[model samples]
Target: MTQYPHSPENPMCQHQPVCPSAEATDREAARIIACFPEQGWSLLCNGVIVFEDTGELLPDGSSIAPHRGPARHALAA
Candidate 1:
């Protein structure tokens, strides 16, 4: 498995406000911190914040992008 940098050594959040998720990872936590206004919505850790959420960044970010599928036709032949 790909070892992410932000994987917590201990099963606890190392930030001011404790994180409830035990499954949280290092990169994942950093991404979430980036969204914090006080934190300037960006954690420039070992990984780069290519995006505020998802894509080049980690899988799950602050807000998830909606699915983009083909539009359905109202008038059927």
Candidate 2:
């Protein structure tokens, strides 16, 4: 349960928006302001920009990384 500094009390949500605040300076950091329609809350934070749709942050789980098998990326020379 590693928590990011800018994240809110709870990072439990499916849809988190990309921060468009003064704090966010670049597209790399990906700071976002998310609005939880279900829980009725909002959060401001910076994280890995997994997916950005039309400059808006979609749900967190919207872009899940594909699971990798036992294969390794490193090549033994």
Candidate 3:
């Protein structure tokens, strides 16, 4: 079995209020431990890697596809 980087008992967050867990829906809110804008990716404290396009790779090696919100259209007068 593959070993995940983060777990409930070993959450890697060190922030004051504590960031969300890797299993949480809001896991992307975790603090960024490392970032590489040139590579278009960032590593979060909860052991997740997020990309510039909003795609994600969870600690367990599962992937979350890019989830950008719909673009806003200007209101017609």
lDDT of 3 by residue, 28-73 (tens): 8889999999999999998999999999998899999999887565
lDDT (C-alpha) at residue 54 in model 3:
93
Clashing pairs in 1: 6-26, 7-26, 34-41, 34-42
* TM-score between model 2 and native: 0.18
- 1-77 per-residue lDDT for model 1 (tens digits): 54433325323235434333422444444324444445333433323343433423322354334334544663442
Query: Candidate 3 at 14: error in angstroms?
Result: 1.5
What is the TM-score (0 to 1) of candidate 1?
0.21
lDDT of 2 by residue, 1-77 (tens): 64334435233322344343322334333434565556443333443333222233333523334334544555432
Reference-based lDDT, each prediction: 0.37, 0.37, 0.83
Candidate 1 local lDDT, residue 45: 36
Q: Which parts of model 3 have CA positions greater than 4 angstroms off?
A: 1-10, 71-77
Of 1 and 3, the candidate ahead on lDDT is 3
- Please estimate how well model 3 matches the true structure, expressed as its whole-model Cα lDDT: 0.83
TM-scores for every predicted model = 0.21, 0.18, 0.76
Q: What does the lDDT read for residue 41 in candidate 2? A: 36
Ranking by TM-score: 3, 1, 2
| Of candidates 3 and 1, the better by TM-score | 3
- lDDT, candidate 3, at 56: 97
